[model samples]
Target: MAKLLLCSLAWFTFPSFADNKPLNSPVDYLSVLLSLVVVIAMVFMLGYLMRRFNVTQHGGGQMKVVGSMALGTRERILVIQVGEEQHMLGVTAQNINHLARLETPLEVPQASGDNFKNKLSQLMQGHKGKTDE
Candidate 1:
């Protein structure tokens, strides 16, 4: 009985590596690489489809955010243009309220060639001259 038990234990205890085959062949590696490439291509294709369909875009047709101002930490004022009319909205973290509607729509400013740093330096110089006088 002891001999039978020892023989059975030894038979099950050790894994046989006599076959000694490598886990992944070159073809296996190539298949894995091809699968990864296919997955990445699918992700990019999905992104392209989403953008082409404008799935995640906002304010496309009449309504548009013309300007916004930060009031506090989590509060803002937004000027939105819808067709010919403009509306000012007060927005907070928890609530949105209509402030006013402008009779004439505000013109959106165009970006000029003047850099912000140059304008800031000019403003600082003007303030210094005023303080000296």
Candidate 2:
């Protein structure tokens, strides 16, 4: 009985030992490399699609107000150029509530500037005062 049990165990263990041999087929290596390439290409394609369709179309020209009554909403600070004059408009979610209007539009300055920051901060302060009153 011991011999029979040992024989069966040896047979089962022999098959498992064969499985430890490294995969030696070119087909297996090619399949693995192809799968990796496909996954990387898919990731890059998805990113490109997102940039082309979603981000580039609608993710430009946004401004943030420093301190104001407009607590939670996307504020867009627009510098509209009409000939030599530029108009600064703060458009809130509710309506085109005039936060501040620049007389000369300050030469289409970059989004980050002392003038823009000061104006946005002052507008917010004024809006807060009005709401408190």
Over 1-133, each residue of candidate 1 has an lDDT whose tens digit, in order, gives 6469545543443223223444356664565466557657877998999888657756558887889999899999999888889999999999999999998889964323335667888999999999999
lDDT, candidate 2, 1-133, per-residue tens: 6469546644454443346655477765665566557657877997998876545442134442322333445766665554555555667776775545556445444443466799999999999999999
Off by over 4 Å in 2: 1-21, 55-133
TM-score of 2: 0.30
**Top TM-score prediction, candidate number:** 1
lDDT of each: 0.73, 0.58
Alpha carbon lDDT of residue 10, candidate 2?
44
Number of the top-ranking candidate, with lDDT as the measure: 1
List the candidates' TM-scores in order: 0.40, 0.30
